[model samples]
Target chain A: MEKEICISELKRLSHLYDIEITVAKKAGRRWSYIVNAGEEKFLPSQIVDQFEGYALFVEGKDFDNEAVVNAFRKIIKKINAQKGG
Target chain B: MITESSWIKKVIKEEEYKKYMNGEKDFINDDEIMQKIEKNKNPDPSKIRNIMKKSLEIQTLSPDETASLLNVTNPLLWEEIYETAAKIKKKVYDNRVVTFAPLYCSNYCVNNCLYCGFRRDNKEEVRRRLTLEEVKRETGVLAGKIGHKRLIVVYGEHPLSDAKYIANTIQAIYSVKAKTKNGYGSIRRVNINAAPMSIEDLSMLKEIGIGTYQVFQETYHHETYKKVHPSGTLKSNYQWRLYSMHRAFEAGVDDVAIGALFGLYDWKFEVMGLLYHAIELEKRFGVGPHTVSFPRLTPAKNAPYVQKTKYKVSDENFKKLIAVIRLSIPYTGLIVTAREPARVRNEVLPMCTQTDASTRIGVGAYSLWGKEKEQKLNRQQFLIGDDRELDTVVRELSEMGYITSFCTAGYRCGRTGKNIMELLKSGKEGSFCKLNAILTFREWLDDFASEETKRAGEKIIKREMEEVKKSATRAYSPQVVEELENYYKRIKNGERDLYF
Candidate 1:
């Protein structure tokens, strides 16, 4: 089976990174995929649920200056955003 | 006349050269070998031949030379040694160490290793060999832990936990091709580290896509080996153990790892024997050890040697041996295990992993977690030298300017077997570079690497392209470089997916 970093992991990444942003992505995406909160080309798929192929990031200086934690926030916010949508 | 001729014991002169050439030999530390080599400014082959009647090159390196090679502080020498490793890495791998885990399918054994808790005679311990389903479950669990790209099924030698059971387990490991099967599609390889097998059993594993066949001699000295291994599979024929690599080679398993458990014999003699073994294998077959391991004896549940000081390896000395081994056999991969503490393992391991770009990994190391003691982790076989987490190791490698890689050119290409060695010996460096280039890119594109790791990999790629450019300067194709650039962009943007 394709074991992904589960969608629930975004919350964990969010909590760990200490940031607030909304995140959503295509479902079934490998959750270990770290989204650099800095890049523009990396974006969420238009199809909300099938978004396993894409992700959203909370743009901020945090993403660039400290990407490790920033990636966590982006991933969590993206996951949470998708759930809300 | 007999008594007069019997003056021969004195005439024998106890020559150091005699032992190495043909019989049971009197080996020396590096100090002695170098002393002899430097004694005469003018190395008169004829004169030395008149005194010793031996070829100058008829020898493996002495213990001190082995040690000196390990003490190799120069990056220039490291590059010289690692160049061959890099070339071989380019051929068999790229910048990758194919990760796997040891599924402790059975703890049963019939041998008394004197140093192992799982040895057969340890009646005080609860002995358990997992059933087929249990084995499957463990494999199922392990498949998820390391992301299932490969697995190394480990078991102690016992009658019940025999070849048939092992073969079945291999199938079960492979059968769980889906993550929902509580298995993973990630586990593409399974290497076995069990007892010496029959031709038939070895054949089964060969058919099973087992990546490599590995066995440690523990100690190459027969007397010491028997003394330590009083009552197990190891107690049998020492020759069988020595010749096992030959057997695996014959069975069509190209990748094999051989190691000596240090502190068992005079470390110097053991190193000489190891060199002999490696040289013999390469001379016998075009390919030698896919990897070599140096597992210093450490504490275990039933281990009795913790207090034994006679043969223990000093950290500085062991590191020396490791360095020399890297320099001596440039093409072969060297492995350092968690048997030592994190400090030692951390210091020595990078030499094999990054600077050397070694193909070695922890024997049953499930992840970078083996570097540290984590509650969720398995009870490792021995005390680990470094207990850093996997991500930490990746970060450290990157921080240290080494690439944390996931390249696996071996899987994508058919370089396994006589085919690979032939290409290597013939100096088909381009084919090798091509293979590693493909794998390094694939890894960067998929694995959850950090930015620093990502950057190191990028630098390595650029440096390697420049290397390829330098060698084939005018003749180099622009297409390969262009393709690499696109992959780099995709990786940077996180546009590619695993196996995409």
Candidate 2:
């Protein structure tokens, strides 16, 4: 089935700046490579950090400690970075 | 023997403006034009000779003749020309429309093609190449969004996104499950479209079950190609793009989608060249283009050279061009992309067109989500004309009398290369066609089509069977006749749809 980012609030907040990764295979139940972070760039990949994941960006710093809503801010920051901001 | 003079090119450029009239080429002034247009009538068959002659004689036309042909207002001629074309179509396709869609593996490109929004020079451009794991991820997402059983995996061939990478991705998409049809389908096959690659690259693609390889010439003329394409391997070798399909065929990829970016050429010459290419393929490999697409130029960033690529066919003429394709190849899958508006898209949905639900929905709808309140995209090549939902286009087509089919004839029947050629060229009707007609009628009636369309199809099929009987001399046993009669009668009587 077509998988969607489970986080609705994260989607709404980061929808503009963030990338909609094509969710690749999920490893270990949750960690999946959505899309290769730097695979698409014209420049070099090693210079900038990249995330290939089954996880959605959360507003919180730590998945263990913070609330889910805060992850939107965190996700948005990642998304903006992907945009080369 | 053919004229290769640059002056001939001038004739083409002049005629494009419709200033000079070639008496032999002008259909409007032809006496049959008025008779054919006489108020409310089925086309006169006597006009067929002239029309056929016209279609053949003006095989390649100057722009003026092309414009005149497109300007055909005679509804009778339109019906007759299209019907003949449909005959050609039926011969090859036999009531089947092959369906497939692009699974963009990566948006990354090395070229600064002047017309493409994906050009690296365009700073606003957002590019992404799905990694192997990411490729699999996109495949999963696409599998869910998948509408048709055949997949056409597309990617830009940057050095990073090489042949091996694409080959692996092809395998990846094929192996992934789409809501679990369990290999019965949900995307059974793949067709590849990317830059022209070596025979080795094509072999890898074929090994991965890549069915057709599509590479658009964009424009057949070389200098214009250089001008528009600007900086890339594409600009360096126009011949590579032209003969890519040919080379692909050599590398064991027989099914190929050959098309030109329509707005970029002298439309008539371009079309005739397409037919010529199909004819050439038939001569070479015993089959024509597996599919033909005519994607018009939609607005894109840094695409200022779009006008220089100018062979603008208006919406009306676009329909006329489509009709010509239906008449010309008649059998190949004629594809119309999301580059058109909703109204035009809906209006032209039936006349020789192929599309998938995914293309019209979820993500492929990227090009179509014009100025809406909220939209998401990596970035799009151009705007989309049709903004209708899948259900909406389905409804409208049914209402307007069309078979909204998702039938994948390629998967079930042994229909890809020579098998198809043999079936069509044998000049003998068989059980395959009979069963296809029955199944198609029933499927459309039950699901994708409207009540009125279903009725119209039944009526047309009944009339067509009588014609078929006359056309086919083979006689059948009494029991088989009874069975066939019962099948038709039961269907006509509004029986439940059944697959044979």
Candidate 3:
């Protein structure tokens, strides 16, 4: 997917889940993510991705367990598919 | 790509610039700043205490209040102000002092600033801009060898090293993850200290992961500004430089730093100018400067203006300025650089939050660090006072009850811009600072600390953990406390880059 489109999709998904995402670092295979302000989870580049930086952060206690993460992954997949990836 | 002659004209966009300014003028009012300084002289002790109380409440002081604190002449009252300032720093930032290395990437310039050694007119100064490969090489020594996690990457304002070059250099710094003991070291935060840029360039830098876009106004006084920055030069436009932070915010860059080179003007008036600048930022963006730097003018090679300036700030007044700035803008981070000698740094660091250690200001000096005992003044922007190694400085800070923090977790975790501003004012950020400081200090100690320094650092970590356990449920979550203990154990066992 185009970088801007992927970022917009991530923001949309984050807002849908009522989660906040802070962009950190660039896209790399060994990038990580944090969910609901808990432990850092290693992110597979194929599953979890971002445009600017790979470390997407979700703080506070508003989102469900792994739901926001799955939703974001789905968005990335759907957006990449829409662009014929 | 801009050509040489037209780049200066194209750098400042007139229509966008007008939006942030009041008609043709910038926010700083010289007459008002001087009048405030004059009127607030001989302030009563009770009034001074009241102003200090406002600062303790984390409220940004008014110009009158800041001026009153600056006019304080009574040594006993100055002592009280000093105590109050220290208390404010402890309240807002906790007792952790952040450490970073300054990488001066270039010495080329387009302006003839009279106070700077890198002025275009200086024929004796050696001018060079580091290549991307050289920048990575320099970062290797700073991060891999020295265990520094943050860098304030500096660049001179020439067409060759403009914003595009800055963005590229930052990427190079971040890409370097050199192997350290047990784990890797890389610069997570790259703050820029370059010339002012347009909104387009500033936004590009933000997209490329620039942290803390810093531009020092050098001197805020208009007449002095014109005298120093020669006419027909880009930096001669006082409004453009004054409103750099405004342009930064408008471009969506969250963390902008403001500063002044103090010796060029009256120290008291300069403090007032800094306060006004902070107030203007807060009024416009709902967030003030992320950090405020006041580097006293030291002698620079080929810059006769340094010795000729009559407004040189004495060591006593330098301490006073640090205290007053801390009291005036209680939430902002105060940077006391390696410009002052170790004696002066020790005296003033109680009121300051961040400082650089093992700092080398010459172009590509970090890679050539151990080969030379003394810095080449012609290649350096100014002489550095404290050239102690990072381990030695870290040990001293630990002995002083301060944990040398290598944490850039706040930027990564999104506690920036207005979010950081709110946390700092409410004193909630201190909790996060304490937690992260411990984790990152553990990382540094394991990776790069000397045997003697490691012992001192371990003592500090133990004391900090004890404090966390004591405070317990009030400041931290039960889950957080548990996780911190687990993380601490994991980091000690050779893990790296762990944070809450």
Candidate 4:
């Protein structure tokens, strides 16, 4: 089941992580979140399907801090790997 | 009366500088760059070849990889690197050699740099600045008489040539439409080479439709920079100049240029510094410098440091450094100015994308042609080695089987900033540029070329069109190709300025 995340919660997480978060309409009435660390860009929802329970956490339905942190770490690792780390 | 101090106060805004700095620090970590160079002192040949492959793929090499390339001394390996540099330039920029003319707008400077002829303290240099009328007159000659489509307008750092003045001059240059043989001629693109400005001022220029905003670091070595640019001067503030591009990007300026004056520092270290600057920009903004220039130090009338520099780059080493830079930043346009002699420019032309012809470094030199024939060091920034006219250069390039392109379609067509970077890396920009280059070349030959040069250029044009039809069918659809053919015929029949 999918849950809706308010823009305010996403803004709070962006501030905490020191990342620039932007939400834009992907399609008609469908929204997507863009995460940027300087020039490195990523979409949390694209990788959310790869992690169990991560999509729920991103949507503000599940309040598992551990799972959310783990999901963010995986995305960061992928970005760094692309940068030839 | 407007005093010099008041003008200086108006030019350097302190708060603007403070906003961009990272709490008294910014990019250009000198120690880190030095440490990386030291760690990669002796790189293996196999590893270097692998890094060259990365550049072949149009990927920007890391500073570490660039450092290793600079350290290459094996004769055979150097030859291979040079060949690879030519290949990369062709793959990214195609076989077109873009040409421009350097139009010096002003000689009034504020800082007393040790190496420049326009330094404030140089009593021998004749201080001058062109009014809007004079700039238009000069553009009339450059566009109508000389047939140059692009210009890199050079300005000294001072109050009279502020952002507003710069914007007005650009407008004047673009307004001039001159008469040519078959059709009208005009300066289509005007790039700037001037002092750094605040974001607000840069934004003002952006609104006026300026081309690339270029600011050279002069020398990236901190101690050398301080020694050359005295303390308490605007150019002495290294951090402010270092972050000029960052501010320009924030101000909505898409294309920014970076360069370093060779012979001011060790050439190898300077090359590494240029690579680091490009990497940092890509890391922070996802776009690197649109062009990188390496103008060797030349003799000036009263600037003794120019001739007495201990770190002067030899001709052999200068060629090698250009090759290394081409391999390091495959997608960026490398410019070889007229500062080098004709022989040297010919030797290094294959590895560079652009060069200046009929370059006049004196203010109003184009309008005052016969009077300014002799290269007077007191009236110019630095003496140029290649003083050949534009028609001669066009003839030589045609003889070498390379097309001389005057296309400005990419910038006008919205292929700038990150869009152009993506296209360049994907190898699609060259294809688009090829079609436009052919159209513009036909326009130039019809409107400005001499009879002797036109005969030589026609053969090259026919060969280029055959290549386009054979390899670029998908890039140019059948309908587009038909339109291109029509445009080419129209240009030969007295029409001009036709592009895709």
Lowest lDDT 10-mer window, candidate 1 chain B?
Answer: B49-58
Q: Report DockQ per prediction, comma-separated.
A: 0.01, 0.01, 0.12, 0.02
- Residue-wise lDDT of candidate 1 within B261-288, one digit each (tens)? 8887766556656776777777776667
Q: Over all chains combined, what TM-score does candidate 3 have?
A: 0.89
Local distance difference test values of all predictions, in order: 0.50, 0.51, 0.83, 0.78
lDDT of 3 by residue, B1-500 (tens): 66867877777666666777777777788999899999999999999999999999999999999999998899999999999999999899888999998999998998888999998889999999999999999999999998899999898888889888998899999999998988688888888899989888987887787878899999989999999999999999888888888888887677889999999999998898899999999998888999999999998887878989999999999999999999999999999999989999989988988989888899988888688758889998988899988999999999999999988876665567876787799887888888889999999999999999999999999999888878843356565667789989998898888775
Docking class of 2: incorrect
The candidate that wins on lDDT is 3
Q: Once superposed on the true structure, which residue ranges of model 1 sit more than 4 Å away at CA?
A: A1-85, B1-100, B131-148, B178-185, B231-234, B353-380, B423-476, B483-500
Candidate 4 lDDT over B191-305, as tens digits, reads 9998989889898887677778999998888888888899978899887788788888887677889999999988887888788788878887788999999999998767867
TM-score of chain B of each: 0.71, 0.70, 0.98, 0.97
- Per residue, candidate 2 scores C-alpha lDDT tens digits across B269-376 of 556556656776776666778778887776677777675655677887777777776555645667776567767765555555466443522223333333342323
Q: By descending TM-score, how would the candidates be arranged?
A: 3, 4, 1, 2
- Most TM-score-accurate candidate: 3
For model 2 the local lDDT of residue B453 reads: 48
Segments of candidate 4 deviating more than 4 angstroms: A1-85, B14-23, B370-372, B472-476
Q: Sort all candidates by DockQ, best to worst.
A: 3, 4, 1, 2
Docking class for model 1 is: incorrect
Quote model 3's iRMS. Answer: 8.1
Candidate 3 chain B: worst 10 consecutive residues by lDDT?
Answer: B472-481
